[model samples]
Target: MKILILGAGQVGSSLAKYLGSDDENDITIIDKDEANLSSLQRHLDIKTVCGHASYPNILEEAGIKEMDMVIAVTKSDEGNMLACQMAHTLYQVDKKVARVRTAEYLHRKELFSDSAIPIDFIITPEGLVTDYIKRVVEEPGAEQVFEFENGLVQLVETRAYAGTPIVGHPIKELHEHLPKIHMRIVSLYRNGKAIPAYGDTVIKDGDRVYFVTKKSSVSKVLKEFRRLDKAYRNIIIAGGGHIGLNLAKHLEKNHRVRIIELDKERVIEIAE
Candidate 1:
């Protein structure tokens, strides 16, 4: 597959690295910075084009017509949208993925369609990060939480701490501890290496454990691994940036939330 990526920032560069690693993918990235392009060229087996990504000539120079997929991840939301629009309108690319960070643009769902913006997919980093933090906060013991099967099932990652009920216990004993909860230990990691999660495999302190369970039983099952922390009530967020503001918005209705930002203008904006 031939892929064209716009922007050479962290998101773009990371995407390029991952996609370029695949033997079947021919990845080309575009950015305005010559230094970033040069750096990517040296480190990855992908092509780099330095120019304004939303411009037609630059897209053509990056071989947009031959691209099977176009991913626009520029820092500017307008630029990303325009790049996707141009790819769809000009090249008629099969897939157009764009990172549009502005809540204003994302809220207007009708703007993105075949007769509109024509973006096949939209990636909102702020929204993604906010949802991730929400999951972590909701599950007291989990370091990471992923929902699957329409929220009916969940995959949780947590550290085995000393004094936990499951610490030093064999995996087979989990059922005995939590008789009503249904859960499974998918994988275990110790010292950054995988350890088989067999029935006789014991959980040790500092071990990273991944488990799967029904969403309703997640909290109950987590207690077997570690003591659940008290439910969060009062919360203090240090910044009023997009991620922080979004988090505060989600937590405010249920918890006492306070936001502290250095910039007075941003604080005023957040207050409104």
Candidate 2:
């Protein structure tokens, strides 16, 4: 795999360093700053190209046609979008990821409708971080939450609260309520280990619960347990990385989240 990353800044540099460590992937990092380029050249075996990567010519010079993945993490969204668009349209790169600040381009369908630009994925660091915080705050009991099929299928994570109403209850007993609810306790995550259990598996307090259910029935089942997780209305985040940006985009639609970052460059990138 060959990866072309624009901008030798923190994110791009980190990505390249990790990618270069993998023997299977070849990485090339392009940046407008010679000093930044030289700095990365010291630590990794990745190729470096010095230029303003927003220009299509720079991408071509970097052999974008041979690249398997193109990542645009430039300071400016316009630059990232342009690089990604060119990678998709002209070079036909297999994967194109552009780092955008506002997230409007990704959230808005009309933005990607343009014929000239065809970006496969748009990444928002600030938004991701915000969403993670929301999950932790709103469902402190749950380790993670994943919504599938456009939110139709829900996978919820929770730490079984001590003395939970469902504690010591067997799966067969819980199924008696719905009879046809179609609930599955796929795997148990306990003490950092994952174990597969059968229907006889007992629900234990403090055990991590991974439950899957139809989106509509999620609330009803949660209510049955009297809801042990935290319900966070406001969230305060300290950093605005890809995680923060992705979180805000995901949770802000349904919840309130705030992120704080002190770096001016990152702040500008996260701020619309």
Candidate 3:
């Protein structure tokens, strides 16, 4: 696959490092800084072009016509979207991926498809982080939560405390304790090291536990390891930015959520 990556920031460099090593991928990166390109060219097999990512001449100079996929991760949302649009419009690139963080652009997702923006994928880092934080907050005692199968199934992590019912019990006892719930103990870690998570594996106090189950049963499944965490009823979020506002809106349903923004104008705008 021939990939043309816009921007020479952390994401662009990391992508080049991973894809450049692959014998099957021919990676070309564009950036405004020659220093970033020089650093990449020194360590990777990928080609680097120096220029504004959204510029038509820059895209042409980077061989956009031959690229199988184009990835735009520039700092500016407008620049990234424009590069993807150009890649799709002029070159008819098969795949166009852009990292757009602005809340306004993401809210109107319909603009990206067809000939409008022509972006095949839109990566919203702010939205991703907000969802992750919300999951952690909603699932009491869960240190981390990840959804799978379109939110039907979830993998959760929590610590096994001494007071919990299944803390000192065998892994198999979890099923016996909650016969109706469908859950599986995926793994366990003790003293910063992985422990054998066999059926007879005993969950000890201070041990990190991982489990998988349906989203509906996640609360019940998590309680098996430890349930000492008091459910959060009141929350205060700082700032009125996209991430902060989104998180506040999601949590305000069941919890008393308040947001503090330093910008008075922004605060009034959001309040309305």
The residue-level lDDT of candidate 2 at 114 comes to 41
Candidate with maximal lDDT: 1
Ordered by lDDT, highest first, the candidates read 1, 3, 2
Give per-model CA RMSD: 2.2, 4.6, 2.0
Compare candidates 1 and 2 on lDDT and give the better one: 1
Query: The CA-based lDDT of model 3 is what?
Result: 0.89
lDDT at 167 for candidate 2? 69
**lDDT for each candidate structure:** 0.92, 0.76, 0.89
Model 2 local distance difference test score:
0.76
Scored by lDDT, model 1 comes in at 0.92
Query: Model 3 reaches what TM-score against the true structure?
Result: 0.91
Question: CA lDDT of 59 in candidate 3?
Answer: 89
Weakest lDDT window of 10 consecutive positions for candidate 2: 132-141
TM-score of each: 0.90, 0.74, 0.91
lDDT of 1 at 153: 91
Model 1 regions lying over 4 Å from their true place:
161-168, 190-193, 204-207
